[model samples]
Target chain A: TQLLEQSPQFLSIQEGENLTVYCNSSSVFSSLQWYRQEPGEGPVLLVTVVTGGEVKKLKRLTFQFGDARKDSSLHITAAQPGDTGLYLCAGGGVNAGGTSYGKLTFGQGTILTVHP
Target chain B: NAGVTQTPKFRILKIGQSMTLQCTQDMNHNYMYWYRQDPGMGLKLIYYSVGAGITDKGEVPNGYNVSRSTTEDFPLRLELAAPSQTSVYFCASSYSASGRAYEQYFGPGTRLTVT
Candidate 1:
């Protein structure tokens, strides 16, 4: 079983502060995805990192995939109240049958609370 | 388009009771998934369907069953509800294509309380 461990199960920060969430795993993954979920709502995809050592940026959010594909991180710059939510990281890999598109194994999740 | 829709936003079930959670997607996606989120825990895959008439077990498929009879609908069934089954359920859909990645669109969510 693939397990992704996330740090800082809970985080609270004031507006304009920066924060980073980490997702580490012992197993390698073919791809990693980040999601943000709001109360009473399902998670929404924020980004997908397929290549090792890959980095992608969305506005003030930056995502990085580890060189060994065993870890990933989400960094929020100038965090705001709107960025507060449950952030999750999911890792995906192929089965022995070579079926690459499989269900993801998610991390424990990080709950971010930003106050303005 | 209503990317994904789940009916009966909330439900409460007693032990041994059975219920079906309805899910529908209008985007004609071939990949549909059912997941459950426990308190302070990340979502766990319950079941998934690659296409109509094709369903498979996921990470946590115990006590859950799913069916995909049409491209637009995939419903999950829980029989003999248990308190351990209480959680927020989400339905999601994504397009399936070789070498192409698609983001999944999720429904609001269904909060089920089992007593």
Candidate 2:
């Protein structure tokens, strides 16, 4: 089974503090996606990184995919209270037989709390 | 568009009861998925359908069933509700072509409790 292990399941920081969440696995994936979810709502997609060693930045957030395609990370800069939420990393792959398209395996997720 | 919509935002059921969770997407997505999220955990796929009339079991498919009669609807069925079945259910849809990365749109989610 392909598994993605997320570190620091819980995080609390003051506003403007920076934090980084990591997702690691032993299995290689075709793509990786990041999502942020609020309480009582479903997760919203933040970004997807496919190429190895690729980096994408969205304002205050930066995401990177490992060169081996077995890990990914999300780094937040100057986090605000509004940035507090559940951050999830999902690895995407197709079945070996190529029957199922875009199957995803998700990590436990990181709960970030940014105190104002 | 409505994206993906799930019915019965909240529900309570007793042991041995059965219910169906409805999910619909107006985007005409070709891929639909059902997932369950336990408290303080990540979402686990229960079932998925590649298109109308094509369905397959996922990681945690035990005690659950799904059907896709139309392109836009995929409903999940719980045969016997158990305490372990209590969790938040989410429906997602995606459209993929070739090798490009596709985004999965998620519904608000349905909270289910079994006593």
TM-score list, all predictions: 0.95, 0.97
Task: Provide all candidates' interface root-mean-square deviations.
Answer: 2.4, 1.7
Stretches of model 2 off by over 4 angstroms after superposition: A94-98, B97-100
Docking quality (DockQ) of candidate 1? 0.57
| Top model number, DockQ | 2
Residue-level lDDT tens digits of model 1 in A1-116: 88999998999999999999999999998788899999999889999888899999999999999999999999999999999899999887744454644577889899999999
lDDT of 2 by residue, A1-116 (tens): 89999988999999999999999999988788999999999899999988899999999999999999999999999999999999999988844655547778999999999999
Best by TM-score: 2
Candidate 1 global CA lDDT score: 0.89
Span of 10 residues, lowest total lDDT, candidate 2 chain A: A94-103
Cα lDDT of model 2 by residue, B37-109, tens digit: 9866899999999999999999999999999999999999999899999999999998764464557889999
DockQ of each model against the real complex? 0.57, 0.66
Provide the lDDT at B18 for model 1: 99
